[model samples]
Target: MSREQVVELIPALRAFARILCPQPENADDLVQETLIKAIANLNQYTEGTRLKSWLFTIMRNTFNTRYRKREREVIGLPPDSTNTLVTQPDQEWSARAKEVYSALMRLPDQYREILVLIVIQGESYEDAAVICDCAVGTVKSRLNRARQRLREELGEAVED
Candidate 1:
């Protein structure tokens, strides 16, 4: 991929990386690593395949690798529960966004990743499914389940 193409995709990569990693520095590193990877593996990418999809796939794999590393160092963190919020907003928005964020963080990695790709990152379901390596129908079903579980966790407060 040309430098220009990589530059154009940086913002999207940033968005995805930011969601995957909490710190700005960490997110930047993740994006940087992803860029290096995408470039290095450029020849392996199929011409007709989506570049953005490939980029996201790299980001996801990188995030999982990092998470595993972190997990080995410490194990006290609660397993990401579908009911925990992943939304964030220490100020403004309300505690709800943070609550939502926590719930999102708690969700199963598969469901949470799809939610971010489709809902937070605004990628198409097809793109999300492609990046997620699942069928479109599976993506839809997971999204439905994620939303339902999140709503159930928030209960009536989410409706207000």
Candidate 2:
């Protein structure tokens, strides 16, 4: 892919990175690392392949690698820090967003990743399957099950 084409994909790449990472700075680092790797490995990218899917695969792999590394060297916050971090609800939307994000975090990685791709990021099932390295049918099944789980977690009635 050309540099200009890669530039065009930045917004979508950043959004995907954000979904994988909770911290803004970490998400930014992931995006930067993704772009660097893409640029360095540009020759491997075949022409006519989906560029967005390619970038997303790189981002996901990068996140997985970093997540595993961090898991080995985990850090702990000070004991009293948790109490200090609690905030009174300043707005309804923010509170709701927190609840939804918390629920999303509780899901299995497979379900959460697929849900973010298809439901939150608005990617079609085919495209999501490509990014996720799964079959289209698998993406559909996971998305359906993920939605059902989310509904249960949020106390919403599941329709047959």
Which stretches of model 2 miss by more than 4 angstroms? 68-92
lDDT of 2: 0.78
My TM-score estimates for the predictions, one after another, are: 0.76, 0.81
lDDT per residue for candidate 2 within 1-160, as digits (tens), equals 6899999999988888766765555778999999999999999888998888888888888888885355223213444554323221224567677777668767877899999887767788998998888899999999988998888888789885
lDDT of 1 by residue, 1-160 (tens): 5678778988999988866765555678899999998889888888777778889999888878775355323333455742222223345656778788667767776777788888767789998987878899999999988887787666634542
Which candidate has the top score in lDDT?
Answer: 2
Q: How far out, in Å, is residue 129 in model 1?
A: 2.2
C-alpha local distance difference test of each model? 0.75, 0.78
lDDT of 1: 0.75
Steric clash pairs (candidate 2): none
